[model samples]
Target: MSIAGQIAASCQRAIGITLARMMSRRQFGQTLFEHQALRLRMADLQARVDLLRYALHGIAEQGRLELRTAAAVKVTAARLGEEVISECMHIFGGAGYLVDETTLGKWWRDMKLARVGGGTDEVLWELVAAGMTPDHDGYAAVVGASKA
Candidate 1:
C-alpha cells in the first residue's frame, strides 16, 4: 500500500479505537459518545475517512497512480490523519497520555512521522498545485477523467 493508504488505514483504526472508548467511558452520568459534541466530531471524522477511502479505491480501480494524485493523497492523508488522531487523543483525555491504558498516544506519534515521511506537505502541495492549471485540471487528471 502507498503511504497515503497506510495513513488512511491508521486514521480508521484511531477512529475505531475512539468510538470504542467513547462507548465505554462515561462522563457526566453518561457514556462519552452520548454527548452531542462528541457525536458531531465522530460524524465529521467518519465523513473525512470515507472520502479518503473512496479516493484510494478510485486510484486502485484506475490501476495507475499519477504523481499529482499520489502527492495530493499523501498531503491530505498526512494532514487528516494527524488531525483525526489528535482529536481522538483529546477525546481520550488523560488516558490518551498513558501508552499502557490507550493507544492514542502511539497513534498520534506515528501520525506525526507520516507527515514527514513521503515528503513534507509544502513540497507535495507544490507538486499538486503545479499541475492544477486551467488546462491540466489536476483533480480530473488524478481521477483519470478524459476531460475536466
Candidate 2:
C-alpha cells in the first residue's frame, strides 16, 4: 500500500480502538454527551460501527492496505461521519453546517478525503472479497480445479 493508504489504515485501527472503549458506556446520553464526536459515534452507533470496524481490521491484516483499505475503512467511518456529524448538522438546522467548531461543516468538506483516498470503493470490495481469478487461476488450482 502507499503512504496514504498506510495512514488511512492506521486511522481505521485507531477508530476501532476508540470504539471498543466506547462500548463500555452505561447510557446513551452519557455516551453521546460525555464523549467527543469520534467517541460518540462508537458508543451510540454500536452495530454498524462494530461490523465495519471488524471488517476494516481484517482487511488491514491482509497487509498492503491500499485505497481499497481506505474504502473499507470508509464503510464504517462514513457511516459514523454521517450519523454523528451530519446529525449534529441537522440538529443545528443549518447553523452547525456553517460552523467549523462543531466540525459538521469541516467533516462535510473533509469527507471526500475518506471516500476516495487510499483506495476507491470498488477496490475495497475486491480486496474484501478476494476478487477475480488470475489468468493463471492460481487459487482455483490450489483447491483442485484443473491445473493451469
lDDT of each: 0.88, 0.51
Clashes of 2: 3
User: Quick one: best lDDT, which candidate?
Assistant: 1
- Residue-level lDDT of model 2, residues 1-148, one tens digit each, is 2433333443344345334434544355565235577455445545554555576567668876554445546554653544544544543345456655444476555554555665555666677567334656666567665544
Off by over 4 Å in 1: 135-148
Task: State the lDDT at 132 in candidate 1.
Answer: 79
TM-score of each: 0.87, 0.41
lDDT of 2: 0.51
Q: Which residue runs of candidate 2 sit more than 4 Å off their true CA positions?
A: 1-71, 131-148
Give a tens-digit lDDT track for model 1, residues 1-148: 3787888888888889889989999999999999999989989998998999999999999999888888999899899999998898899788897889888888888889999898999999999998775756775687786554
